[model samples]
Target chain A: GIQVEQSPPDLILQEGANSTLRCNFSDSVNNLQWFHQNPWGQLINLFYIPSGTKQNGRLSATTVATERYSLLYISSSQTTDSGVYFCAVPKDGGSQGNLIFGKGTKLSVKP
Target chain B: SQTIHQWPATLVQPVGSPLSLECTVEGTSNPNLYWYRQAAGRGLQLLFYSVGIGQISSEVPQNLSASRPQDRQFILSSKKLLLSDSGFYLCAWRTGTITNYGYTFGSGTRLTVV
Candidate 1:
């Protein structure tokens, strides 16, 4: 089993501040994804960056697959972006998309 | 475009009560379905998944069981709920492919057992 660990189990920031979250995997992975679980318990897809860099609005992510690490950057965060950010890794055995999730980084952006 | 639907938004049940959560996917057939549980602010835990009708693989051994009666429908049921069974239940589906099948999660059901 692959263990995924996330940094800063809890976080609090001002509305205009920027922050970066990290995810580290214990083993090789075929895919890496980021998700945001809102206060209402809905899981929203953020990014699916197995490698390279991708940006969506004020949020961006970069995965260095060779180093088995991924970084998510939230720039000028907003109150609506406050949630539990999780990183999931897909096993490399075959085509099973079952994800091994990290405990997540709980972010709170105060307005 | 694929969409997943989960119902009841919220539920409260006695410790011994039976429970059933339904999830359905539209615009796709033979998709892979999964059930996950989140305890408070904890991470999502994989409970079960199905590749097709009547095919289920349990990721955790618990009082929970899942069934797929149709290609687009997946159900999670419990014979008797436990206080520990109280959590956020999420239903997700993705296309079964080697390339990539990004999962689309439902709004989730909040269950409380007392």
Candidate 2:
């Protein structure tokens, strides 16, 4: 089983500030995804980056597969972004769909 | 496009009562279904996954069980509930293939056992 650990278990920032979150995995992974869990308990897909980088609106993600780590970037954060951000990878590499999730980084954006 | 639906946005059950949560996927067939739980202030924990009808794999040993009676239906059931079972339960699904597809989660069911 692969272990996924996220950094800065808790984070707080002003509405206009920017921040970076990191996720480290113990083994190589073929699939990786980022999600934002809102206060209503909905998991919203943020990105699916097994390797390389992707950007969606004010948020972006970069996964360095060789290093077995991923980075999530938020620029000019909004108060609505307050929630838990989780990164998950396939429990077994390749076709296995079982995902191993990190504890997550709780972000609070104050207006 | 594919969509996942979960029932009973919220529930409150007695400790010894039974439990049943339903999840259904539409616009797709033979999709991989999963059940996950998140305790208060905790991360998502994989409880069960199914690749097809009548085929389920449990990731953790607990009082919970899952069943897939149809190609797009996944059910989570408990013969008797426990106070520790209180949490947010989510249902997710992805394409049934070996591609790099991401999962789509339902709105989740908030269950509180007393």
| A-chain TM-score of every model | 0.96, 0.97
Q: Which stretches of candidate 1 lie over 4 Å from their true place?
A: A92-94, B95-97
Q: Per-prediction DockQ scores?
A: 0.72, 0.82
Clashes (candidate 1): 0
Q: Quality of candidate 1's docking, in CAPRI categories?
A: medium
- Interface RMSD, prediction 1: 1.0
Q: Write the per-residue lDDT of candidate 1 for residues A1-111, one digit (tens) a residue.
A: 888999989999999999999999988877888999888788888888889999999999999999999999999999999989999987555365788899999999999
As a whole number from 0 to 100, the lDDT of residue B77 in candidate 1 is 100
Q: Could you tell me how far off, in angstroms, the CA of residue A71 lies in candidate 1 after the best superposition?
A: 0.3
Q: Please list all clashing residue pairs in model 2, or write none if there are none.
A: none
List TM-scores of chain B, every candidate: 0.95, 0.96
> What would the TM-scores of all predictions be?
0.96, 0.96
Give the fraction of reference interface contacts each candidate recovers. Answer: 0.56, 0.80
What i-RMS does every model get? 1.0, 1.0
